[model samples]
Structure formats: C-alpha cells, structure tokens
Target: MHLMSALLISLLLVSGCKSTTTRTGPIAVGPGVTQSQSPSPEAKRYTYNSDIYLDVAIPVFNPGFPIDDDTGHVDYQELDELDIWPQLRRAEAKRFAVETKQALAKTKAFGSVSVVPNANTSADLYVLGTILHSDSEFIRLEVTVVDSSGEPIDTEDFEHQVSESFFRDAMNQDKDPYEPVFVEVADYVYELLTDMSEQQKQQLKNTTLVRYAHYYAPDAFAGYLSQQLESKRGTQFYKYELNAMPAENDPMLQRIEVLRNQDMLFVDRLQDHFAVFQHTTNGPYRKWQRETLPEAVRAREARSERNTKAVIGALGFIAALALGNNSTSTSTAVAKTAGALGSAWLLKDAYQANENLRVASAVIDEMGQGLDLTLSPQVMEFNEQEVELTGTAAEQYEQWKAHLRKMYQLESSAN
Candidate 1:
C-alpha cells in the first residue's frame, strides 16, 4: 500500500513540473504565448575567384490563415476571435520577407538580396517563406530555398519563442525581437550556398534568361529546358535543367533579354512597396506585442498553476478513497470528508484560473481590435505615364507581368 501511494505521489510531482524558460505547447488562437531567443553564429561571406555572384529574390511570405476547406477562405468573426485579421496577416507577410532580406543582405553570401514582388521573379536563387504562426511572443516559419535549376537547397521549419525580458531588452538594444530568427535563417542559407561550387552557381545564372524567356514565350523557349525525375525515401520529385543556351548575341535572345531587363527593372521598383510596409507596420506590431505582454504572462502562469493543482487534487481524492475503504474509524471518516472537500475546492480554483485566462484573452482581444494597420498604394511610371498601381500588391505585379507578356508576343510576331 505504501509503495502504491509513493508511486502516485511521484507521478504527481513529475506531471506537475513546469519550465519557466521556454514553452512549445500548442498555441491556442486569441491566447497569449511565451518567448525566447535563438542566436546563430554569423559566418563570413562566401567568395570565389570568379566575379559572378548569384542574385537572390525573396517574395512576400504566405501568411497563415486557418481557412475553411469548404469555403476556401476565413470567416471574419473567427478572425476577430483569433485576434488577427486579413490586413494584419497581409502586412506581416511582407514584413517578415523584408526582415529576412535585410538579414540575408548582411551575410553578403550573394550579390544582392532583393524582396521581389513576384514569386516567379527571374533570379539566380529564391528564398521563399510561409508564416506558420506568429504572435506577441512566438513565431514559426516554413522556408524553402531553390535555385533557378529548381533544385531544393533547404526546405525546413524555423521557430522562435521569447519572454517579456526579451522584448524589454530589444528596445534597449535597438533591435527587433524577431531579428534573431531572421538572422538564424540567413546564416543557415549562407552555409548551404558556401558548399555549392561556382560552376553550379553559374549554371543557375545561365538558366535565368531561359526561364524568363520561357515565361514570356513558352512555345519559342520549348526544348531549352528539361525536367529530371528523382526519388528520395520512396517519394518522387522533378528538377528542371537547361538543355541548351541561346547564342549571346542572337537577335531573338537579345530581344528576350531586353524584355527580361524591363521586367527586372519593374521588380526593382517594387522594393519600395516592401520597404513602406515594413516601416508602417513595425511600430504598431511592436506596440501591440508589448501591450499584451502582461496579459500573456498572467495567462500562462495561471494555466501552469491550474494544471499542478488539478493533478494534486486528483491524487488526494484517490488516496483518500483507498484509506476510507479499509477503515470505519471516526477519524478516518472525517479525513475522507475533508479530502473530498479539498478536491472540490481545488476544482473550483481551477475553474477560477480558467476565468483568469478569459480575462487575459479579452484584454488581448481589445488590443487587437484597436490595432489598425494603414497601407499605401505604389505609384508606377511606364513610358513617361505615371499610373497608380491598383489591386493587392501581388495582384498588381501579376497584372503587370501579364501586360509584359502581351508586349513580348506582339514584338516577336513583328520581328
């Protein structure tokens, strides 16, 4: 009996233990979470005897929204309840992208790291990202890096969690709280590109024009690129490779390059879109995080303590039942009654803890409601005629590319 009782106590102790430093529990929407930093060692920039350095393009990330599979979109009330909205998510998509570009630029592993508006931008390398989760104290990203050859360099998840003190120090140090995570991502990319031979990189650059030309004129560029089937761990995938390179001074090739340069110029101009979004959203986002810090801390602490109390209460009731079954003494009866009452009280306290959680959530919800992120449209100049770029940023870029395709087809036919 004593051994059995000892085992129960040990189980309670083990189950009730909590870590104050970090947490990886599933984050419920509308609830506050925890945080910590992950600092990655910065490596020296990779250099080769050759002067060519691969240009990198990073498109805005895919902002995560819990979409309803049936409708293919999210509900507005659900957004409010989740403490997030479409505007915030869209802004964050660009926000994380520019921050990552900044981090990658500091590494100097590539010639230039640009936050391109087009996901299919003609660059030697692409670092694409998806936002899995982000909040006041934590963030997770699903990143995929590929070269023009369509070879996957790295496809992995990166996450970070931080505490209140981390935010306090971020202001003092004049750094963004999310900067460390982006820096870590950049370092990982630099290390991988270092292992790639210069010839391999040049190959990626070589295909840039072919890929861009194909985008504009698929039938004309056909047979210039081929796909190879690959199998790994019983999974099949395809990687693209250039079959032939057009002559540098070929009239048609020169025309395609001219079109590609025009497209690239348009893309370079869109950097201002990302830059403005970062500047506008940074202040409100940080302010929201700091304002909700207290509520988050209280909610987490309450949840931890509630779990511990519930566990102790369950163990007490079991022990009391065991003792009461063997004894009919007046003292034993009183002891059982008191043990049951204690358990009930603990249960009540657990309910109260949940109420505290609700209060914290409400506080965060109010803060979320008050957060308004303003957006500005981009102005684009084409043939000395300046026009306001309409539609979503992504939509505007896609429309511009479509217009470019028309121009290419008309010119090609005339030639």
Candidate 2:
C-alpha cells in the first residue's frame, strides 16, 4: 500500500517537471510583437530631422467611471471614467512623431529634431493636434502645422470608425496591443508632411517673372487689358497670353511694344464709329477729342505701340508682302502711311493715306483670307477726316467717301 502511494506521487511530480532532454511549450518571441522585448542600440541614438513640439489639449484616459475624490483631483477621477480610446490616441500621436522623426532621419530629410511641451520656444515648425472625438469604437484626429509666424501651412482631419466586430476581434486577448489605427495614422501623417515640404521647395525654386512695358506701369495697364480680354473670353486665353510674355532678362521695350499693338487693334475697332462722328464734327487736329476720347483709346494705343515694336523686333517678323520684302512689309507700310497721313496715325490713318484700289489690294494681300488692316487716305478722309471741302482737301475727301462706300458694299456681299 505504501509503495503504491509513493509511486503515484512520484509520477505526478515527473509530469509537472520540465524535461532536460527536450520540451515543446510555446514559440519564443523575436524582436517583433511576439517578443517580450526588442534589442535597442539606445533611445538617444535615434536621429531626428525637424524639431516638433506637441500640444495635446484633449483629456486622456477616461473609462466613464465616477470620480474618486479621495485619491486625487475630481477632474482626474472624472477623466479616468471615460473610455480608453482617448488615452490610446494620445499615446499613438506621440508614437507617430517619434516614428516619423526616425523614418525621416534615415532618409536624412532634415538636420535634427526635438520634442517639447511648450509651443513658444521658437521652433522651425509647430504641430498642434486635437482629439475631436474618441470612443471605444471610433476616433477623429485633427492635426495642423504652423510656421514660425503661426501661419497655418497645412491641416488635416481624419476619422476612424471601427465596427463593433472589428473592435471585438482587435481586442482579443491573443491579439497584438498596438492597434492598426496607429500604423495607419502614422503613415498618413508622414506622407502628407513629406509631400508638402517637397512641393513647397519646388515652388520656391520655380520663379514666375511679371513682365511690364517700359513707358507705362505693367501692373495697371496689363491688369486693365487682361481684364478686358478675360471679360470678352475667359481666363484660359489670358493665362496663355500671360504665359507668352518674355522671360526675365528680355528687353522691356520689346514686351511693351507687343502689348500696346495688340491692345490698339481692339481699341481702334471699338472707337471707329465714335471716332468717325467726332472727326466729321470736330476733326482729327485736336488730338482725337482731348476731353473724352474714351479712356480705352489711350490705353489701347499704348498697348498697340508695344505690340508693333515686338512684332517688328529682331525676332524677324514681316508686316508687308510685296513679294520683294515680306519681312519688312509692316514697318514699310507704317512708314509710308505715316509720311503721307501726317499726325492722324491713332485713327485709321493708313486707310486715308493709301489709294482706294491700292488700299483694297493691300488689305487683300496682307491679310490673305481676312480683311486688310491697311487703310487708304481716301477711305480715311471719307470715314474719319472731317473738313469743309475746297480744293485738294475736298477732292481727296470726296474720293475717300466714294471708295469706302464701294468697299462697304463688297464687304457686305462677301460676309
């Protein structure tokens, strides 16, 4: 009886004891989640590029329990009563910053980083975060980046709502403690900050030149013309036109000329009817109506001169095509028109300066498929010139009126 009892006890002891020969209990953890602890070089060895200071205002660690006044402050106890999500989120934010710094350090994106409590210590960048919402099953994180001047450079709001089932699965005893939410948030923040920095740097490097005319202020005149053009069409044309401006170091006079010429054409057409009436009543001798010639006329003239110079510039543009000199055609035409017409170039002086048939031929020849920009003296005298007829002036005026009428008829039929 004694031997049997002793044998039973010995058997129980042997079963509980771990064998020296071999034993299979559980898998050993490595440096990952399965491990009890991971090997580290040292916390201080971690590199950081930018200094970041965190300001966490939201209450942390609440499980919705009543305050325990005897233990500590009532507020602290009340906070403890809330759910654990807030505490988890705060922990996650800190972890995120640390991880981000480490990651950036590996890439050598910045110099060094330091995390602090005070936001007023003078840092290159400041990061502020708020826990807008926190529950057992969901959380909303709002983050903002401000420059040294307290100007907000970037902001983002992200909400993570986990299903009840997901929470249950995630909270299982066997599951890892570091939530998937933490990983996701970290990745989101890292990508956003990196991308923003890169974009800002590129923008700084790419300089935009604002070119203006030499005579008049570029901002006001260009702005006026841009408004007109954009009003007629949309922003698309203006964008293209502005993009077409000369680059930095180019001749300012050349740009001014181009702008003036383009604006002049539009102005000339708009004021032609009024100009004609004015000339018939007042004549072109008085500076095309000094009081009110329409503010656009002056501006347009300025723009047109700019354009004319630009077109005739060394870039090699030909204005007239007499077969012999298509290269210098426009300049040659302007000089001849100016010499014959005198000082009336602002209004359709070209039309009055050229002969009727020659004007028609020139318009057809120059524009090719469109109406000729060239004006004849006879046409100008009838259309724009106003005077009491007597000898040469009257005859010239009468001839211009007749030719313009004929051209008008042809124009109507063609249209």
The residue ranges of model 2 lying beyond 4 angstroms of the native Cα positions read 1-113, 162-415
Summarize candidate 2's per-residue lDDT along 1-415 as a digit string, tens digits.
9999999999888986845457467766566535424342442232334433221111111223334677654455344333222333343444333333333344333333333323422234445555554433345656555433234556666565444343233234333222344444445444544555543433221211232241234443353223212222221212212323344454543443444443333223323432333233322212211221222233334445545544343123222223225435766777645443432332233333223323333322232122111222322232343433233322433443344335444543575
Model 2: lDDT to the true structure: 0.37
Taking all chains together, each candidate's TM-score versus the true structure is 0.77, 0.24
The sequence of per-residue lDDT tens digits that candidate 1 reaches over residues 373-414 is 243566655445455556766667776777677776777788
Alpha-carbon RMSD, candidate 2? 40.5
Which residue runs does candidate 1 get wrong by more than 4 Å?
1-50, 67-87, 167-173, 228-238, 314-331, 369-388
Worst 10-residue stretch by lDDT in candidate 1?
367-376
